[model samples]
Target: MISNLSELLAVAPEEIDVNEPFSRLGLDSAAAVGLIGDLEHLLGRSLSPTLAYDHPTISDLARHLGGEGK
Candidate 1:
């Protein structure tokens, strides 16, 4: 997920702080949609269009999607 975000943001993967709000990383709604599309493709499943808003941070989203435990 961090790799994907870094690619989208044109930043190094290490620069993506997991706890930071995606909006703080410059991910506006449109960008979030684009991100969701990428994630859907990668995950091989449909996801809520508002998923980004629903989980505003990388860690939050990852946890919600069962990527990481609490």
Candidate 2:
């Protein structure tokens, strides 16, 4: 997920703070939607459009997505 966000934001993966909110990471609605799409493709399932808002932070989202969160 960090890799995905880094790719989307065009930044290094190390620059992303898992605990930080997506909004603080400069993720807007369009990016969030794109993120969900990417995740859906990667996970092979559908996801909610408001997932980013619901999870808010990378760690939270990761955990919800079945990853081991930091």
Candidate 3:
């Protein structure tokens, strides 16, 4: 997820703090939708367009998508 987000934002992977909100990382609505599209392609599954808004942070989203305990 960090790698994907970093690539989307054109930032180093390490620069993305998983706990930070996407808005704080400069992800606007369009970019959030784009990220969802990228994730859908990579995961080969459909995802909600509002997923980013629902999760809000990388760690949260990762846990939700990965089925990790949150």
Candidate 4:
């Protein structure tokens, strides 16, 4: 998930801080869609852009993808 997030955000995997905003990572809706597409393949479920909005950082998204979403 972290690797996916890093790829989607166009940053080094090590550079993504859970404390930082996703916008700072330069991700927009287009990238979110692409990321969701990949996630769907891995998770065997669809993910909406709303999930990207709700789950901002990699850690948050990891939790969500892990099926423990808030």
Candidate 5:
């Protein structure tokens, strides 16, 4: 997911702290679309870039993708 973000926004992984807001990671509309496409390709399904709005931190997104815990 970080790779996708890097590819879309042209930002390095080291620059994006998992604790940092993706917006702080320098998000924009066009790059957001690119991110969505890349994520869909990687995840093999569709997801809203709005997910970024709700899950600002990458760790949150990882948990969301992980689904319910045992």
Candidate 6:
């Protein structure tokens, strides 16, 4: 997910902070929608269109998807 955000924001993966909000990384609505599609493909499950809004930070998103806590 960090890699995805990094690509979307045109930044290095190391530059992304798990605790920071996606908006801070310049995740506008279009980017968020694209991200959702990528996530769905990677996760192999259908996700809500508003998933990014519900899980605003990388850490929060991880927890939402039952991943290890950041």
Largest lDDT belongs to which candidate? 3
Better of 4 and 6 by lDDT: 6
How much does candidate 6 score in TM-score? 0.90
Which whole-number lDDT from 0 to 100 does residue 67 have in model 2? 55
In terms of lDDT, model 2 sits at 0.91
Off by more than 4 A, model 1: 67-70
lDDT per residue as tens, model 5, 1-70: 8877776677786777887776788887676667667777888998886766777777777777678432
Q: What's the C-alpha lDDT at position 35 in model 3? A: 94
Off by over 4 Å in 4: none
Model 5, poorest ten-residue lDDT window? 61-70
Query: How many clashes (backbone N, Cα, C below 3 Å) per candidate?
Result: 0, 0, 0, 0, 0, 0
Tens digits of per-residue lDDT for model 3 on 7-63?
888999999999999999999999999999999999999999999999999989989
Index of the highest-TM-score prediction: 6
Which candidate, 5 or 6, has the higher lDDT? Answer: 6
The sequence of per-residue lDDT tens digits that candidate 2 reaches over residues 18-50 is 999999999999999999999999999999999
For candidate 4, the C-alpha RMSD (Å) to the true structure equals 2.0
**Alpha-carbon local distance difference test for all models:** 0.90, 0.91, 0.93, 0.76, 0.74, 0.89
Candidate 1, residues 22-59: lDDT per residue as tens digits? 99998889889999999999999999989999899988
lDDT for model 1, please. 0.90
Instruction: Return the lDDT, model 3, position 24.
Output: 97
lDDT computed for candidate 5: 0.74
Off by over 4 Å in 2: 67-70
All candidates in order of lDDT, best leading: 3, 2, 1, 6, 4, 5
Shift of residue 66 alpha carbon in model 1, Å? 0.8
Decoy 3 TM-score against native: 0.89
Give the TM-score (vs. native) of candidate 5.
Answer: 0.74
